[model samples]
Target: MSTQPAAERETVLIRSARDVTELVNSGAARGSHAKMIVLLALGGIFLDAYDLTSLAYGITQIREEFGLSPAGAGAVTASISVGAILGAWLGGVLVDRLGRYRVFMADMLFFVVSAIGCALAPNAEVLIVFRFLMGIGVGMDIPVAMAFLAEFSRLRGKGSKGSRTASWSPAWYVATSGCYLVILALYFLLPDSQHDLLWRFTVGFGAVPAIVILLVRNKYMNESPSWAANQGDLERAARILRDSYGVDAVVAEDAERPKRESKPRASLHQFRTLFARRFRPRTFQALAVALAQTFSYNAVAYGLPIIIASLLGQGDLNTISASLVLNLVFAVTGGLLGMRLANSAGAWRMTFWGFAVQLTALVVLAVIGDPSSTAWVLLALFALGGFMFAQGGGPGANFMNFASLSYPTELRGTGIGFNQGTLRVGSTLSLFFFPVLSASFGTGVFWVIAAAPLLGMVALLAKRWEPVGYDADAVEHEYQQRLATPEPARG
Candidate 1:
C-alpha cells in the first residue's frame, strides 16, 4: 500500500461501511434521485394495496357468478392471504440474500401475470389460483418496499426514517381509495348486460400500474447504499452514494474491508436471529402490532361494503359511495396526519392510542348491535370511520416502522419478513372467517373484532420499545470502533 498521509485519508476516505452509514445518517444527500427512489418504492406499495382491495366490491359478484357456498367464497377470498404467507416468508429472506433491486423487479412480473390470469380465469378454482399468485406479489413487495424507504432516508427530523416508513400508510389508503374510484367509474360506465364483467375488469386493471412501475424501475432503481455497504462492498456503496445521494465519497485503495456479519444466507437460522436476546423484544412488539393491525384492518376494510349495505339496507351504488367517502375522508386523512406526527409524537404512542381508539370503536359497534334507524345507522358509520381513521394513522402506519427500524440493515429484511409472515396468518384467518362470523353472529361479530386491538394494547403495555428516532446503524458504528481499538496485549 502506498503511504497516504493519515490526516488526509481521515478527511476524504470512506474507511468502513460505518463511514457510509454515517454519511447517510447525517442527511447530507439532497438530490432528486433519492426522492425518485422513495416514490418508486411507494409505487410498489400502492400496487400492493390496490391489488388487495380491487376485489373488495366484487366478492359478492364472484360468488354469484360461480354459484359458491359461503365456505367456497371464503376460500376464493382467503386464497391470496394463503399465498401471501408463503410469499412474505420467502420474499423477506430473498430480499436480504438477493438485494432489494433484484427482488423488487422480479415481484412486479408476479403482479402483471397474476392480474392477467385472474382476469381470464374461467372457473372458481382457477380464480382462486390466480388470486393466490396475486397475493404472492403483494407479500413480496412489502419487505423490499420498506427496505427502500428506510435505507433512503435520514434518521431524524422532517421526512425522517420513521416518517418515511409511515408514509406507506397513506400510500396504502390512497391505493385503496383509488380501487373504489375505479369500481365506481365502472359501475356507471359499463352497460347493464356487461355488469357481470365488473369483477374481471377491476381485477385486471391492477396489472396496468404494475406494468408502468416495472418499466420505470429499471432506470431509477439502485441498490440501497446501506445494503451495499453492509455486504462489505464499500466501492459499490460509494458509487451509489455518488449517483443517488449526491455525495462524492472516496474509498481509499488501501482501506481494510468492512467486516461482514457471520449470518448465513436466508434460512431458519437467520429467522432465529430475530428472536435472539438483543432483537427479541423488538420482534415481539412487531409481531403483536402487525397481527393486531392486519387482523382488524383486513376484516373491516375487506368487508366495508357489506357492513355499509347491512347497516343502511342500501343498494350497491349507495354502499360504494359510503365506502369511498369513508376511505378518502377518514382513512387517507388519518394516514397523512400519522405521517406528519410520526416525527414529533413517536410511533409507540401513536400506535398505542390507535389501538385504544379502535378497541373503543369496536366495543361501541358491538354495544349498538344492528342499526334500526337512520340515526343509529349514522352512529354505526361513525364507529367504522373512527376505526379506519385510527388504523390509518396509528398501527397500520407504524407496524412497518417497527419492522423496518428496529433492526440493523443486516437483519432488516428477515425481521420484517418474519413479522409479515406471521401477520399474514392472522390475515388469512380473518378473511376466511369474517364472512362466516358475520353470517353466524350478525352484529355480534364486532365483539370478536374488538379482541384484536385489545391484544395489541396489552402487548404495547407489556413491552415498550420505541423505534422512532433510534439509530439502528449504531451497531455498525460500534463494530467499526471495536475494530479500530487495539486488543490488550497478553499478560
Candidate 2:
C-alpha cells in the first residue's frame, strides 16, 4: 500500500524504479532525495567545468616552461580533450552496464592523479600524458552526471532537473572565470618573483574541487530508482523509494492493464539498439546538436581569449584578466538568458538561432580578420560577444538537454555518452586544428570555425523534436508503444 495513497485512493502496486519515477514525476512524492542528487550532480559539473578551462589559463606558462612550439602546445592542450573522448565512450558503456554509483565515484581519482601529474610534470610529454588522464575523468563525469540528473530530478513543465542540466553549460563560464580569478590572485600574491609557478598552481587547484565533489557525493548519493527499475528489480526500486524518499510503495495486486507491455530487456547491444530505426532519429538529433555545439564552442568560445591576446600582443597576464571579465559577463548573461528562455523560447528554436548567431559572428570576424585598428578590434569583439551569448543560451543550453531527454534509462547513459563522446571528438579536433589553422590563416580561422555551425544547421534540418519539458518516462513509453505496434512496410 502506498503510504499517502492508501488512505485516499486504492493502493497502486509498485513496479520498477519506473513506478517510483512516475510518483516523483506526478508530484506524488517530493523530498531531499532529488535535490541532494542534483547537488551531487552539480558538484561533478563544477569540477568538470573547473578542469576544462583551467588549462587555458596556464597554457602560456606551460609553453614557456617546457619550451614548446605551437604544434606541441596544441598536442598538450588537446591531450585532455582526446582523453575525454575515450572516457566518455567508456562511461556510456560503464555507467549503463556497471551502475551509476560505481562509475561516478571512481572517476574522481583520475582527476586527482592527472591534476597532480600536470602540476609536477618533468617534461611536456609527461604533462600531455597526465592531461590525457585527467581528460578521461572529465569526459566520464558528464554522461554519469547528466544521466543521474535526468533520472532523478523532479521536472514539470521544465522543472529543477532541466534547470540543473541547463546549469551545466554555465559551468564552462564558471570554469573560465574561476581560472582567471585564480590566476589573477596568484599573480598578485606571489609577486613577479614567484609567478613562474603560476601555471602549476592553476592546474593543481582543480583537485580541491574534484576532492570536494568526491567527498559530498559519498554522503548524499542514492541508487537511481529508474535505473534500478530498468534492471527489473522491482523490490529494490520500491525500497529505494521508501528508504530514500519516504514514499511507501506496494506491489500491484493484479498484472492486467489496458495497454501494458513488458519493459524492454536490459540488453547489452547498446550501439546496435541506438541505430535501430525507432531510436536512430533520436540518436542522430542528440549527436548532431552535441557535435555542432562543441565544434562551435571549442572553435570560437574556448579559444577566444587566446585569439584576443595574440591580436593585441598582450602578455598572458592581460589575456587572463580580459578573458576572465568577458567570460563572467558572458556566462552570467547568456546562462541566465538560456535558463529564463528555456521554457518560453523552446529548445530547437534556441538551437536554430544559436547556430545562426554563431555563423553570423564567424563570418563577420573573418571579414574583419585580425584586428589591426582599434575600431576593427572592437567590432570583432562585438561579434565574438554575439557568438558567445547566442551559444551559451542556445546550443550550449540545449545540446545536453537533447542528450538527456533522447532515450530511456536503459540506454540513457550510453545515449548521453555517445553525445558527449562525439562532442569531445569535435572539441578535440577543433582544439587541435584551431591553433594550427589560426597560425596559418590568421582571421581566416573564423571562416573555418563558421563551417561547424553550418554543419549543425544541417543536423538540425535532419529532424526537429523539441524536448525541453517532456517527461522521460512518457517519451520512453511512447517509443515502446511504437515498438509494440507493427508498421506498414515502406516502398
Candidate 3:
C-alpha cells in the first residue's frame, strides 16, 4: 500500500456499504445528472397526478355518456384507487426485488397502455377497467419515484432528501393544474358539437407524457448507488457514485465484498419488517398522515369541480377557471413553500399546522352550508383555497417525507409502499363516497371530511416522530457494521 495519508489518496476509498451511505449523507453537490434523475422521478409523479385528475373535469361528461347512476359514477372514479391499492403493494415489493430503474421504467408502460385503453373505451365498463389499470401505474410509480428522490439527495441541506421528497407535492399540484389547463384549452378548442369527446381527448393525452418519460428514462436514469451498495455490489455503487453523484469514489483494493443474496427476495416478511419494534412508531405515524391526507385531499381536490358547479353554483367555465387558479396559485405555491421550509420548520411541525388549517377550512365550509350571497360564496372559495394551500405545503408534500425518510434503503420501498397502499384505501373510500355523501347531506360532508385532519393531528401528537433531520439509514449502517464485525468469541 502507498504510504499516503487517507486524505491524500487519489480517490475516496469505498470499503463497504456504510462508506457509500456516509458519502451520500455528506450532501455533496451533484451536477446536472443528479438533477435530471430527480426531474425524471418528479416526472413520474407528475404523470401520476395528471392521469388521476385528467378525468376530474370530465367525470360529468363520462356519466352522461354512460348514463350512469351516482354509484356507477363512484365505481368508475374509485376503480383507479382500487387498482392503486394493489399496485402500491406489488410495486413496493417489485421495486425492492427488481431494483428502482427497472420498476420505474416498467410502470411507465402501465401509464401508456392504460391511458390509451381509457381513451378508447366504448362503455363505462371498459373505462372502469382501463382506469383501474392506470391506477396501478399511479400506485407503483410513487414508491420508486420517492425512492429515487430520497436516494439521489443528500441527508441535510436546503435541498436535502426531505425537501426533495417533498417536491412530489408541487409536482402533483402542477400536474393537477396542467390537467385543468388542458381541459380549458379543449373546452374552447373542440367544436361545439364535438364537446362530448373532450374527456376522451383529455384521458388519451396522458399517454404522450408517459411515452416521453419512458423514452428519456434510459438516457438519464440509473440504479441508485446507495441501493446498489446495499445489495452487495460495491463496484457498481462506486461507478454510480462517480458518474451520477460527482464523487470520485473507488472500491478499495482490499475491501471485503458483501455477500450477495442468492436472489432479490420480497415477501410478506419484508412487509412485516416495517412493524418491527424499532419501526412501529414510524409506521403508525406515516400511516396516520397518509390516510388522513389522502382521504381529505381526494375528497376536496377530486371533487373541486363538482363542489364549484353543484354546491357553489358556479357555471362550467367559472368552475374550470376557478379550480385551475386555486391549484396553481394556492396549491402549487403552498407546495413550493413546504419544500422550501422542510429543512427549517421540519416535516412534523409543518404537517401538524397544515392539518390544523385544513380542519379550520373544512369547518368554515361546513358552517357556510349554501352560499346565499356572493360574499358567502367568496368566503367558501377562500376556505377551499386555504385548505389547498395548507395541503400543498403541509401533509400533501410532507407525507412523503415521513414515509421516505423513516426507513433505510433496505426497507424504504416497503415502507412507502405500505403507507401509500393503505392511504389509497382511504382514497378509494373518499372518492367512492364523496358524491353520495355530498348528494345526501350537501355541505354537511365537510364535517365528515374534517375528521381526517383531526386524526392526523392526533397521530402526530401521540407519536412525536419527526423524520426531518434524522438519519434513518443509520440503522442499516449500524446493522451492516454489526454483521461485518466478528461476534465476540464465547468463553
Q: Which candidate is the best by lDDT?
A: 3
- Tens digits of per-residue lDDT, candidate 3, 22-45, equal 877776536567789999999999
Tens digits of lDDT, candidate 2, 110-197: 8888888988999999988999998899889888888877776666555555665776767667776787899889988887977889
Give the Cα lDDT of each candidate.
Answer: 0.87, 0.77, 0.91
In candidate 1, stretches whose alpha carbon ends up further than 4 angstroms from where it belongs are 1-12, 258-263, 476-491
Ranking by TM-score: 3, 1, 2
Q: lDDT tens string, model 1, 314-405?
A: 78898888889899999999999899999899899999999999999999988888787889888988998999999999999888999999
Q: In candidate 2, which residue ranges exceed 4 Å CA deviation?
A: 1-13, 158-161, 250-268, 478-491
TM-score of each: 0.94, 0.90, 0.96
**How many angstroms is residue 376 displaced in model 2 relative to the true structure, after the best TM-score fit?**
3.0
**Candidate 3 lDDT score at position 121:** 98
Winner on lDDT between 1 and 2 is 1
Top-down lDDT ranking: 3, 1, 2
- Top TM-score model: 3
Model 3, residue 330: distance off in Å is 0.5
Give the root-mean-square deviation of each candidate in angstroms.
Answer: 4.2, 4.1, 3.2
